[model samples]
Target: MTTAPASGFQTRRIVESAAACSGAVVAGLSLMVPLDPRMMGNTSALEVSLTVLNAPRSAAAGAMLAVVAAVYAMIFGARVAWCASFVAASVLLICAIAISGPVSSGSLAIVNFIECVTAGILVGALAAATLRRPGVGTAYTVGILCGIVIGDQLQMPEAGAAMSRWRWLYAAAPPLWLSVLAVVLLGVGLYWHRDQAPIVSESTVISNVPLVPILAGALMLTVVTTTSEWTARYDFGAAGLVCEILVLAGAALVAALLLPGQDGTLILLATATASAGSAVVAVPHPRWSWSLTLAALALGFLAGRLRPAPLVAAGLTTALAVYAVLTCGIAHTYLLLPVIGCTATAFVLGYAFGAAVPHTVSGMVLGIVILVAPCMIVALRGHENGTVGYSPNWYRDPNGTEGLLPPIVAVAVTLGCTLGILLLRQLRPVTAGHIRRLPGRALGGKFA
Candidate 1:
């Protein structure tokens, strides 16, 4: 008897999907390049403000805009065209800006800010396109983790005295390369596939969006981020610690109440676990840290291929919990634990993100904010307390063991995620439909 050919997705689709997902790597690099200390030269304050503070805020705003635009375009049934046009415009602007030499701190900040916003759009677009597709989602998640590690690993070459022709070109090389690579991969993955009608028009699509929840979530994110930045950087003392906990709790509350059904819970749990896992790997060792990060990325990619179940993600999260405990307990005494933790945590983070890729644009945006907003607070707590795993500096790791509070926070968050995941498994679907249906529901659309 003749066997039937395997079907569901074509080989071309997989390749294209991988290419699209890999654009995330480039997007991640672009987000990180401005944060690199070497790239900032002497602009430390400017760098911190842009990279650590404004970057997350602007990216959150951009992602929200992406959600709106995607919804609007989908209503008009021109999502592909709209997304392509927006992406093309953003890429071109990024290239133009990346090639320009920074004349002053002010100008450099503006340039980097634009790049971050554009990169955010790229991220939002990628999530909208590929997160639901298992193979591509895996690739996308792995690419993101790799980009972070790669950006940290890459060293800028010094400006040689002998080369006098174009000094700015040498300085701007990394960002320029990143911009170009992103454009190429995105073109191959998403641009080329634009002709195919991927998103089907559904009669059940909600025309009137739930603006209240969306705005409420955005507001909560802004407050938490701004407060965290000021509190941590300004040394608010005990009050800061209390405020931090309150704000984080508020953010979570807003996420759960504002977003539909379990999506909020899902986003909160997934990103919290991923962020906690990252803290486990924040070592500054040049050689081993770099190699282990790459290895983790590779392992993550393989794990994604397996399309691990929620249970699998929960198991990996348990491993991170153990790592978090060890780091909090004896990381300072053992020294080598962080190195081992780096590999394990990074791989598990990748797997967890892949396994729980958000299904909605709002979920994606909220997840990003949830991950980023607490970073400064955690870093500051670690720095002040002299913890073993947390590196205060966003760019360069000086191997300073700031405080164990970071890992302790990580342990709490990871445990919450594991519990949430297991609980999610037992619950029936709570919502009427995907959040996409919320678009026109309030205004009495047919389905509403």
Candidate 2:
């Protein structure tokens, strides 16, 4: 008798199901933990740091586990690898607990238990679906169940800590759990369908030759440095704005380069970057800034539809201009005078550069980088001050004691810049006409 080949879809479905179940369990546990009010404080700088700190260590651990599981599946077969990895993780957890010492603090103990159980469940589920044999699935299931049972043994206090914190924690945990679950499901699907063959090689994926890690690292370092400074001074008005602009410019450059060739991927990455960055920036003027950023993104989409090249160029220019206006004089003393004049010069530069670049994704990326680099550098430097105010605060008075225009103006300018880019893109021609032939024609022409 011959063994039947496994279908990719079926394998993906199995992995996805297992991942979903694991995620559900983790999310349920997260809801039981208390929330930290400081995590959502008025200061964006404080809020951002707290958020990162609150993230379940399970997330990082799970990712590492997933990678190990993938390798095990390829080498020793799925079943054995799964069991071994699960056991290894368990042992490591125990060792960590021993080194950390018994959880003397009750709240800390409960939090640790929740994190551990969730991590165990996710790792087990991932292993069960990807491992070579069905038997190990039972072991993985049992291990997760056992971990949860142990978690219950930790016991919860009936009362004491602030209800507000608890409510916040309860509200926040489920989403984090859900996100981790989704990631697990995606990972399993990718792993299960490995036989379908990938467009890009694994080596290329791991190497990240396109400098994504470098960009991400730089952003992370910037956040950490900015956060530290904000903590020391508690003043992040000008500096925060500068950082926000630089981050936007850097993200725009990344989007232009990484996403130009791929529509769906580009959209996903761009949206994630934009949403996160906007959330950080929205701290100063939650209502107006948020509205403006959303509007800009919407207009960007429209511009892409009408004229991708010009829209790309415009985005690059706008990002740079924002950075320059915010930080040039303060941070870039040598280039300050020249940059102020080049504000107008950028429009001509964008137009010519957009027209000259090849209509390929790579060209679009290069153009965005060239357009934004100088501004980004200045913004990055300017944001070092630690003071951040989204918009000017105002006091109401019948006698005209209000000064609320700065924030409003910022939002309006942001919107206007986005719209201007859209107009520019709409006017640029799609010059890839020569290569726009039907697939069959192109293939035949190539062969001929």
Candidate 3:
């Protein structure tokens, strides 16, 4: 008997499924806009700091909640998860309208904070439960996160007094927009995600990576991204923001071509660059040496081809950390240069990791950890330092960022890169070119 030809209907269904996932991502992004503290007129700096930390905690919390919701949905039905997600979206809309009306007190900000945490959990759970493909699910989660980065670049004149004519609409527009998107998302969920189940991929079975390395790597990223944003604001003209993105994309292309090897080894080197540069920048009055920093990062990305990449990278990271400690009173003009160098390393490493993981939810988890850990680590550091009330305690930093942010970034980078390389080895193809799914090892085949 001849094998049946593939059905056009099934092909159409798959296409529809992918479209639904992308649209659902837009809805999730809209849901997150109200949670940003900049919309609230208090403690913007603290909120930014807290934001760094909140992302990872929020992800882990939401992951647990998603598991619970998924189990419950399995027991009951997908409709329940759909309802929970819708209600959360509605509540976010209501809160946005209510908060935009007038200033009640400082405590009202607390309401917004709670809304963010609660909504984050629900959205994450919904994303986890409804999506099947790793690529689609990851797209949804990452879109939800792009809100802050995208918002900062937009030119939305605050709903000010001049727009008093459309004042009500201006205040209500965002929530209204989000509410409509939520309805659309719910409809999509019911139609497409009703009985979908996740498929485990071969890469997931062999690659049991840990979060320990992410924590360390994240610190390096946090310092690099945050400082770069702050400093870039000073250099990039009105068009500077656009330039920043374009430049990074260009750097990504260069790094990808310049470096080729295991994904984990590349990530390890990226973190090492962070470790090295942060040490120099954290000091006072050093010669501005972005060339040195970029050279270090370039070496890192290229180092992955070597058999002893991990050892060399770890030794480099340690050496940089100690060197920075020794050169405690150094400062420089092109401070943003090293950050740019390290940031490029991290970004390239991230996309490479993305390509390496098999299309699975485990891939989604790893992506989020790499992206969010740096912010969370730095946020914790900010709390530990208690508002930088006096002269900076470290980095001889008049701005106080060095004292609170650098150490956290350094520690996170050093550990994350090392551990990531260790995990990468086990995930290597079993033979010269074929892939094998390690049985009973769905969670990074080794640890699980």
Collision count for each candidate, in order: 14, 13, 21
TM accuracy, model 1: 0.70
TM-score of each: 0.70, 0.33, 0.46
Residue 269, model 3: Cα distance from true site in angstroms: 12
Residues 85-154, candidate 3, lDDT per residue (tens digit)? 6555566666655655554445343554545444544544455444443344444433433331122112
Q: Give the range of the ten consecutive residues with the poorest summed lDDT in model 3.
A: 387-396
Give lDDT tens digits, candidate 1, residues 233-342.
56666666665655664555455555544555545455455445545534434344656767776777467446745557666666675566566555545657666766
Decoy 3 TM-score against native: 0.46
lDDT of 2: 0.32
Alpha-carbon lDDT of model 3: 0.38
- Model 1: which ten-residue window has the lowest total lDDT? 439-448
Name the regions of candidate 3 deviating beyond 4 angstroms: 1-39, 42-63, 70-84, 103-110, 129-131, 134-138, 141-179, 191-346, 349-353, 356-363, 366-376, 380-416, 423-448
Write model 2 residue lDDT over 211-291, tens digit each, in one string.
432233234334333432333344356656555544544443343333223221222222222222211111111112322
How far in Å is the alpha carbon of 435 misplaced in model 1?
16
